[model samples]
Target: MGDYHVRFCESLGVKFPLATRLEAKQIEPGAAVAPKTYRFETLWMALNQTNHERYTETNALEQEKLLDKILVGNCLSFFKSLDIFVEA
Candidate 1:
């Protein structure tokens, strides 16, 4: 997943700050599972010139980690509707 994330980030011209591999193990059989540790790249979208940049996350789970949630929240609030939202 590291290589895949790297490639994905390169394509989007984004910065990858955190990278980790996720794995799982089963002690017995019949525990069918496809374990995956996905990689992520965070891109700070500059909302305006007044601030350095707003931490708008492309990942849903990552949104909870920002120091200033309100700072980035306002910047990415527009995307909230788009997250799992379908326009009919």
Candidate 2:
């Protein structure tokens, strides 16, 4: 997961801010293919690391699970899982 975070940070040219948000319009050329790549990294984080950020601890793992499903284009599973991890 640390490796995933490193790659994600490098991709976005930003430090690992656990709860950072990246909208599509905010994506730079450096971020080409990064959305998918980051989804992969987030999946890895959820599957392998402990959640530490105050903003993420509530549903971090579930978010990753949904991300993985969505990235794979599994719409049904994605929505099903998404409902479980909605942020407060």
Summarize candidate 2's per-residue lDDT along 56-75 as a digit string, tens digits: 55576876665565444553
The all-Cα superposition gives candidate 2 an RMSD in Å to the true structure of 13.5
> What overall lDDT goes with each candidate model?
0.50, 0.50
Estimate the overall C-alpha local distance difference test score of candidate 2.
0.50
Count clashing residue pairs in model 2: 0
Alpha-carbon error at 74 in model 2, in Å?
7.0
Tens-place lDDT digits, model 1, residues 1-88:
6678678778989866763555679653221268545432444443343332333533545544543565546535555554633232
